[model samples]
Target: MTIDGSHAEGLGEVEFDDEKHAEDRQFVRALARGLEILRCFQPQEPLLGNRELAHRTGLPKPTVSRLTHTLVAMGLLEFLPNHEKYRLRSSVLALGYAAAATSGIVELARPIMQRVVDEHGGSFALGVRDRLSMICLIHCHSKAIFTLRMDVGSHVPMLPSAMGRGFLVGLPDHERQFLVDRLARVSRRGGQTTQEIVQRAIDEFKAQGFCASYGEWLHDILSIGAPVISHDRQVVLGLTYSAFSYATARATMNEVMGPQVRQVAAVIGDEITRLRWRP
Candidate 1:
């Protein structure tokens, strides 16, 4: 869904609608709005006033004020009297750490990801879908002077990034279609339509084992990614290898990095399955 006035400020907004969930008894509108407020803060733009949060969330300023107050009370946000803004607190970090530690995927994938970057001289990352974007869960980088400026918790657009495309191809058909439709409704970068971009990725994944983004997401970076799915097919994750275009040619990405990422993804999927089966 398109958020009114959100594009004018060039800030990413959370995609949510109370009307969509109004009929569902399990859906809590207040809780969802509160979470959306929290999502408005990015790693680069952490401090946000209530007015900014309202604009990003497309919620009323009064409603945002209430939610921010509640979040501060809950220790998830801290209000700065001097700056008159809110920032994520240690509680949020603790919760995030707890979730990551329990997932077991980060621990399982780190070594393999590190080995790939160490050998290939690039960056390797694992990410999962977070609403309309993919949030990095783990990252490994080579000992190079220059590398991609992204870390764990960084967000990337789903339509343009190889990691996001890899995750999209892993979804069931109907589910993928739902997200594609949503993406089409929002403003997209580059010349290609959202459907065209997504369809190309789907087709590429079918023809090859992995999806590739040759400077589509970032003008100077090249990335190749593949999906890692749980044995039960419930959880889907994306694994990616990225490097500067000058350092790695597109032919090399198509031939070497693509297959390597695909193999690493398969290994991660098997590891996740083993973890699930452990007593």
Candidate 2:
């Protein structure tokens, strides 16, 4: 993985040079296709017919039917009896939870996130962007108040949300623009002006050294986040802490949270450099 100049050169680009690169590519392509089918179900289109799935994935009807049937058999997708459509099932969460439970970063960050939340009295989480949304990988709830309890598979839009912005601010300009253009065209939220969103991203990259979202995605929720780095200084994932309407005081949050976020990000980078991935 490489870091880009915009965030100090964008994460150069993650390339794999495995001994079995060709074989790995085949598996990756299959996974990509499966993910594309899953992505066809969204917040709005939670259930889709075989025809719609074919249209969304650009696969033939027979192929879509077979894929959906396979997913149903695997308990990853479910059929809606009344609607005659298929939607994601709860079993998929088991896969996500198992992956995180076995992942080294999540295992390391789990305890650290708890410590940070306990010390700061705010919610903290580790997340990564999956396709167009940021998915919560691990979370430590800070307060008993109405804080965001985003589950393991909870996905949030990449713009107008602190968790997503934290990852986006460090992205290359081209990638950032791509996200902005796509969201502006297809996002299901309110009348948030694209210019405001772009300027907010720029401001986050400048002043705070992180993105701060106040009631943008969820009402009365406030969050501040920064990108977690790898040994090579690549911004690989994001770390964030959030609080309800009253828990986070504006001045105190600004003075303390930003630096703390950077500190954790640096630690993440150092840890990644020291750790090794297994085959």
Tell me each candidate's TM-score.
Answer: 0.90, 0.73
Task: Give me the candidate number with maximum lDDT.
Answer: 1
Clashing pairs in 1: none
Per-residue C-alpha lDDT of model 1 across residues 1-279, encoded as one tens digit per residue: 111222221236566887888799999889989889888877767799998888878899999999999999999999999999999999887877888888777778899989988898889888888878888899899888887746577777777788898999899999999988888777457688888888888899999988888877677889888889888888798778899998888998999888888889999888888787221
Identify the runs in model 1 with alpha carbons over 4 angstroms from their true place: 1-16, 21-28, 277-279
Point out the worst 10-residue segment of candidate 2 by lDDT. Answer: 1-10
lDDT of 2 by residue, 162-209 (tens): 777787776777877886776666565556666467668668658867
